[model samples]
Target: MAEDIEEHEEDTPTGRKKGLLIGLVLAVVLGGGGFYAAFSGLLPIGASATHAPAPSHNADEVAFVALDPLVISLGPDRGNRHLKFAAQLEVEPHATASVSHLKPRVLDVLNSYLRAVSINELEDPSSLIRLRAQMLRRIQIVTGEGQVRDLLVTEFVLN
Candidate 1:
C-alpha cells in the first residue's frame, strides 16, 4: 500500500516543470512569429490605393461646427415648381486632398441626386441613413476609388 501510494504521488502533477517548459516554448514561438510577420510585412498592411484615416473628433466638436446646409431643389410634381431639401456632409480630415480635387464633382452628384429624390424619401426619418450611404458612394465615385472613408449627415431636414 505504501509503495503504491508513492507511485501514485510520483505520477500525479506535483510541480510546474512541464508547464513552465511548455509556456516558455509557446512564448518563444509566438514572439518569433509575430516579429517575423511584422518585420517582413507579411501581414496585410492594406492596398496602396486605400484612403487615409479619418480625423478623430469628439461628438461635441462635430456638433459644434455649424455646417453650411445644402438645399437641393427637387423638381416639380411633389409640390411647387421646386422642392427644397436640406443636407449636410462630412469628410475625413485626411481626405482633404481627394475632397478638394473632386469638390465640383461631389457637388454635382449631390445636387443631381437630391433633385431626383422623391419627397417621401426625403421626409422619412430613416431615409437619412439610406441617403448617407448613397451620398458616400457618390462622393467616392467623384473623388476616385478609396478616396473618402465615409459621409456623415449632421443635419438632414426637408423643408
Candidate 2:
C-alpha cells in the first residue's frame, strides 16, 4: 500500500508538469501571433503624398475653380433662426484638363443648387448628409461622365 501511494504521488507531479508545459507552449504561440498581427501593415493612410497622385500641369490642363458661393438667408432676421454658409469645391485631379470646357454648365448647376437651398436646411447638421450627395450629383451632371471624381469642400463657413 505504501509503494502504491508513492507511485500515485509520482504520477501526479508528472501530470502537472505536462499540463504546465502545454500551457507555456500555448501562451508562446498566442503571444507570437499577437505580436505579428500588431506589427502587420493593415491600416490605411489616407490623403498622403504616398497615396495622392503626382502633381503636373500640361497644355491639356483646365484650371477653373470658382470661389465658393456666399450663402445667406434672404429673410428679415439673418442671425436668429437662420444660418449662412460658404462652400468651395476642389476639381478632381484626373478631370482637371476638362474642367474649363464645362465651366458654363458647372456654374449653372452651382447657381441653381445654391438658389434652391433654404436657411433651415443649412442650419441643420444632418442636412449636410443629403447636401453632399446632392452636390456630388449636381457636379457630375454639370461636368458630365467621369469628369469629376470627388468634390472637396475646401472652405466651409457656417454662421
Best by lDDT: 1
How far does residue 100 in candidate 2 sit from its true spot (Å)? 2.8
Poorly placed runs, candidate 2 (over 4 Å): 1-94
TM-score of 1: 0.50
The best candidate in terms of TM-score = 1
lDDT of 1 by residue, 12-122 (tens): 675567888899999999999977776565764433213336688765433211124566655565665353433444555565655666666677787788788877887
Ten residues in sequence with the least summed lDDT for candidate 2: 41-50
Q: Tell me the deviation in Å of residue 114 in model 1.
A: 1.1
Model 2 residue 90 lDDT score: 53
Spell out the clash pairs found in candidate 1: none
TM-score of each: 0.50, 0.45
Give the poorly placed runs of model 1, Cα more than 4 Å off: 1-68, 81-94
Q: For model 2, how does the per-residue alpha-carbon lDDT over 26-117 read when each residue is reduced to its tens digit?
A: 99999987666655623232223124463564635533355445454445554433234334445656766577667666656765675567
Report the C-alpha displacement of residue 25, candidate 2, in angstroms: 46
